[model samples]
Target: MDQKLTLNGNPITLTGYNINGNNYFMLRDIGRAVGFSVAWNGSTRTVEIDTARPYEEEQPADSVAPTDGSRYVPQVGDTIRCPDGTDYTITDVSRWDKNAFVSGPLGELPQPTCDWSSFPEIELPAAEVRHFQLESGEYLFIRNLYETRRMQYTLQNLAGNHPDTSKDGKLAYGGKGSPAVSIKLSIPSEISAYSFWPWRESEIENLFHSCPPGTYYMEAWDVYKDGVFQRTEYNIRAV
Candidate 1:
């Protein structure tokens, strides 16, 4: 028996055999053809299929909310776009109450007055990274990565010893604390070309802030349907 296989309208070459006038595909070959993981557990006699990628879950704008007890607390300088398409940049934030103050075309207004937070939910634009020069003849990389998982991000010098370790001595996700860390740079959603300080106020608590000059590992995880699917890694140098 002969049949054509297509994935997303694209032809896929699969290693299959015809048995009793029926087509049977090799488990590993089928998994490889579709970018899936095909593994057998001898003890359990079960196979695990990880369909993490190529099937991204789409989330509605209103569904982007901080989970329960999430460490991602909105800080000063975070920008938010309301449902009405009104964009506001947080100019000032109260350290005590954690309220943000915003400025717009009219003028600067209190956090509540802007009504940006009053909306059911707001969105952070795509994360980005930019570099700028200082009076000291030094360049700094400003990470505009947001706390949301809508897009991916990379960073360096933040990987620490964890309780979770794989057979190869690699740090896995599960541990006593969150494997992911929050970035707190004052960088805005959009960086300007001529602005001396393109990024917002520098955050002292961010691990990248005042980090020693060295090479660091950067990683970003992909989220699907509000669940973390997988993570990617990169290397960045801080000078």
Candidate 2:
């Protein structure tokens, strides 16, 4: 289904979970449309979409299709009014966030949109500390941990080889004694963007403060890519 984003002038096509049930989406897919580079600022839990595009008033739901059942599906060339009513183009179609039913071949709306039938839960890996230097002369230290679930997050202090879950479901590598996760600081020269973990509710707020902005959220997926242990990225940013 074509979705109206509140950032750019194009409609975002939908995949994976149909427009019917709840589903997950990517930050970068909508990041460029919003004029911001999605980054992972571990210090704060803030998905910063930096855009020169001034914030416009959100368009009313009035623009939605007439409730003839055709009103709730995804379609090609469909009008995707961003939250602000900006027109954006739907470029492609594929299964987003991994699963699909809602995500199918590109077809215009008036057709039934996809919906997510199932969403599983996941657990975060123990924290692994990683550090970087920012242009601000400050250090952004990230305690990177991974969770392979779909539900909520639990923060914990991973000291040994295994990190436990936090009271709120958040997790982090204990301290220096634990494994220190490293990140390649240089920006990606290709489509392979790096990811780090950050939570607004996490205890490490100072590390998230040293970012260059445009940070996004931590994404979670299956452990193996195509059936391997390829580490996936997060979908969050430092606040």
Candidate 3:
């Protein structure tokens, strides 16, 4: 038997007949659809719902063991390996929209522009500019909500990299277009502006490939933390 159900905002439309109007749902399909581990407890005539990751208590120790994504609380010095593979230390953690918001700062800063003659006297508040890193070992430049892949050269750092920010390690375009990430750039050369570029997501195969492969138009706010960045709005792309 099948039935319609909504789980975690996902519409699970099932098809099944109701017997005698007694709609005791079938456990198997529904359980798998909603990512639940289900087993019949024959002794109790009950269906045990794990409601979380399945466990193999009797399984032997092996590298093939399964591990579902676990929401771990991150501390300033806690290092976590995300699914993407880069290592980061959680510098801060906050809750926004009922989800974990994490910030990662590289333990170090981006490479300096190394040139300063065209630099301006950065007149904005210090908080107007911040840096963050993604699980791909790439960094972002942000000020409030506006951020870009490029930052004007400063004695400290230059350019927060974004998805389409560089396909050849250079910005072919700036300040407009679809992007996986966005950052506002400001610097001494009067190059201060807003830039939107894609952030690297999914499998990153070529570090020097300019833009990541398989990155679509989908944009997502992320919770990120690294030794170089801290906790802040890794948020929903505003509508």
Candidate 4:
């Protein structure tokens, strides 16, 4: 007689001999396949099969496991992103209010009651810049000081090129055999002018590396709590 055997309504492969309409299979194979531990108990002279349980000897009894990265204590100058996708840099820590004062796009402000348990610490990348040589032999450099406090310093105006005030206007290059181009710099919201570099995304030294040898009008816009508070201009020569 041929008969099929199933467990929990699921077919289980069995290699056994049929006797009196009953089938017997290897106990260890079935136990392993079904996520059970099969062990021989010498004193009881019986096989013990139970649900698999991981050993917890390595962990402390009172320990609590974290779902993601390790626990982080907030500190001043540390940047954090809220659940709502707003990024802020901690400016002050107040234990009395149980909140942190942070700098955001709006201005210096205080965040809601801080509970960093669910929030993961993130490191915002450094600022980036792109250069577009204008048709006037001048350079309209675009800088993005992303998520950081910084300043943009204009070096020289040897080319004596005035700002291309035309909306989306094309600028021609002044150098010999140089191609004329038109491009505008999109200033990021997070960037504002400063007299000196701040804690995050400072690229003061990068200026020398990005621009080629040229004379151009350089300026700096200082970002403040309200907005762009000051502008400084200078004559610069890049060689």
**Per-candidate TM-score against the hidden true structure:** 0.21, 0.20, 0.19, 0.18
Best by TM-score: 1
62 in model 2: Cα distance from truth in Å?
A: 6.1
For each candidate, what is the lDDT? Answer: 0.32, 0.30, 0.34, 0.31
Model 1, TM vs. native: 0.21
Where is model 1 more than 4 Å wrong at Cα? 1-4, 53-239
State in Å the error of residue 21, model 4. Answer: 2.2
Which has the better lDDT: candidate 1, or candidate 3? 3
**Per-residue alpha-carbon lDDT of model 2 for 157-227, expressed as tens digits?**
22111223122222222355321222221223343443442222232232333441222234332122111
Ranking by lDDT: 3, 1, 4, 2
Show where candidate 2 strays beyond 4 Å.
1-75, 89-91, 94-163, 166-234, 237-239
- In candidate 4, position 96 carries an lDDT of 16
Total residue pair clashes for candidate 2: 62
Q: Write the per-residue lDDT of candidate 3 for residues 102-140, one digit (tens) a residue.
A: 233222223543323222233322322223444665443
Give per-residue CA lDDT, model 1, range 126-234, as digits (tens).
4433222346432222122332221112121112222222112222333554323333223233432112111122221143445522222222211111111111111
Poorly placed runs, candidate 4 (over 4 Å)? 1-12, 54-239
Which candidate leads in lDDT? Answer: 3
